[model samples]
Target: MDSVQVRPMQEDDLPSAERASAVTFFEAERSTRRVSDPEAEPRSAAASKQWIDRMRFYLSVDPAGCWIAVDEEAGANRAVGFAISQNRGRLWFLATYGVLPSHQGQGIGKRLLDAALAHADGRPGIFSSSVHPGATRRYRMADFSLHPQMRMVGTVDRSTLPVVDGLQEGQADDFAWMDQLDQDLRVAAHGPDHGYMLDILRLVVCRDGARPGYAYLDDRGRASLLAAAHPETAQKLLWEALASSQGPTLVNCITTPNEWAIDVGLAARLDIGQEGYIAVRGMPVPAPYLASGHFL
Candidate 1:
């Protein structure tokens, strides 16, 4: 373990970091009781590519919070683990973290987490949605309390939704508006370069002539209700997103704090899937709307 070195991640290290994340995550899930749908297709290449994009996005916003663990004995300083974190106002989040399966039990992950927490510096709240039980346990040991959650999946039939007036499709140009909304609603400024998000998801907004809310849905139909000025706006935006998506649409990290979020999930006919836990330390901040499982 002493042969491993921890340092801030460079842009060049992202590809390998993504690969390490995939292997570690896949192997970790396989070790658990979590079952996969037998009829489901093998993991998609696009899914793998999405991890790379997400890591890059997190890095773009919080470069200092990203770290990589390398095995110095490997000569090339091979990356064996990594962590991506961000401070969204008072809410600090561990966006993602993983150690290569082969490198487990060697303290690399601890070092990476230590670096992330040091950067966080006991911020009011730090959060994560942990996929693997081992990860949940690790976070628990780190003094983070756990909240149960799930991946809710269902058919999103837009036909069932009454046409909400003033709702319009959003574009890349709406990045600034969305960032401002995020700051106002969540007290977090996620920055304004989200134009890149439209490249990966369908951006939709509910504008009461003044931008009440927005949502993002990818090609595969995974949708996230980013933020809403109020419960009614959140409902409308959620309905709009559900109306527009296809296949097995998903919303991750739904908790008891938001009755409207849960009601919308039920109204959309989303079925509860594999359970996960959101771990948080410090202040208990409410997250009625989450952008994605990976982000929160």
Candidate 2:
């Protein structure tokens, strides 16, 4: 094992962190496909950038909670592993934790995770989506229990949108209200920076008689994250998202016990892939909520 130091993530560390994440994801995907689906395609450049952007969003909002592992062997100063987390009140979300393939067995990833969680100060609640077996085990060792989770991917059916009273498409400026609604319904606080998703996603707002709700969908109409005052409102937003997607789309890292959300996905005929687990540290999140971004 190299003499690696885990330290607070700095502005200068973004590039290295991004690179390490890309490498780790690519390696993991390749390994998974080799064992489960040899015919699967490799990740595209656009996909890799999207992964980096997700991590960037977390780093942008919670730089202090993010940590990077620097290998200090023979004067080399570089990031071999990194862990990024978002501490939103009682909900501490672990966005990503990975070590370069060459450095995997050295405990660098565990060290980075420990430091990242330490920022939460033993907060009762923690959340993470674990795709790697090793990561799932480590999370369990940290006392996070596993829950059913999966990723759904498919081409959006543009014709699925149906007219629903009071459902309006919104723009980026409408994010403040949407974020407030999200915080109200979610198990944890989501910072105002959530509006960042609006820059790329199309926001669908549901105003069903004073109860306002919204869902974030890619330009083509696939739902990412959604929350509503009621299930009817959420279902309306989900349908609108299904109608808007223009091409291949996905809703990732959703907790499966949220039966309504899962049923919606099944009804829409989306293909479920890469089954994984959602690890929760404290009280588990009661579902029926939309899974959005990387942390969800």
Candidate 3:
């Protein structure tokens, strides 16, 4: 026996957890041929660190459950694997299991998953990994949803919208309008991560010469470009962001059904990508106006 053991995640375990998770993801990803590897080992390390940091940040924001697997006696508790879950039906596994390249075929990966799954308690979840063919197959074999891509829409060519300069000088009416929109959005999105949305949801993007546009980003990266006091301003902001994003070029403005603003995406002329569902068990049958912004 490898003396392997599993337990609730410890906050103290973050550093080691990051390392193990990084190594596991790197090699498995390499095997999968999904995304291009970063420039060099040094840059790759930085990117991994960034990713792990994000995992930690996201975990802190989880407000649900998080866990880790360890080899008790060996002190090899470098967080070889971990799982995180949230309420209102949300869970995500950001793991890098399987022993390092040299440590493979030793049953580490399988054990990690078994333990993680055991912790799931049949809860609903969505796994995040590259969409590489092999990796996709692996997740599918693991029984995750293979077709839950969000509907992403894109469009272009707005000739005369007001360009919001900066958020500093928007009028009081604009602020009041944004506040109303935010509260409306919150009630609409009853997801686990939706509660922590204020920080990400409340945004004011503006142009140098005019009013502002409020932006709400949900737990996922799906975004919503709200109706603003200044249509020209909203249009210009959308135009600029679209040019900058790796999109369907513009912002993803899909909201829950109740969200009156969900239609903003359509109004923006964004090419709504095919509707995709997240594979999971717990996500409540969505209510209304549940516009998810993005997984930041």
Looking at candidate 1, the ten consecutive residues that score lowest on lDDT are 33-42
Tell me the tens digit of each residue's lDDT in model 2 across 1-296: 64888899876777677777777877887776545554545567787677667667777777888898988882455788888887776667777789888888768778888898888787754555546777877888888888767766787554544566788877765666665665665556465446667667777787554677777777566777777777777767776776666677676556655556556666677777756666777765545576664645
Candidate 1 residue pairs in clash (backbone atoms < 3 Å)? 158-243
Winning candidate number (TM-score): 1
Q: In model 1, where do residues sit more than 4 Å from their true spots?
A: 36-44, 88-90, 157-159, 209-211, 285-287
Candidate 1 per-residue lDDT over residues 10-100, each given as its tens digit? 8888777877777787776667544554332334688778778777877888899999998888757578999888876666778788898
Q: How many clashing pairs does model 2 include? A: 5
Per-model lDDT: 0.71, 0.71, 0.45
Q: Order of candidates by TM-score, top first?
A: 1, 2, 3
Which candidate gets the maximum lDDT versus the true structure?
Answer: 1
How much is the lDDT of residue 290 in candidate 3?
27
**Model 3: residues with Cα > 4 Å off, grouped in runs:** 34-64, 72-75, 89-107, 114-120, 132-138, 148-240, 243-278, 281-296
Query: Which candidate do you rate higher for lDDT, 1 or 3?
Result: 1
TM-score of 3: 0.50
Stronger candidate by TM-score (1 vs 2): 1
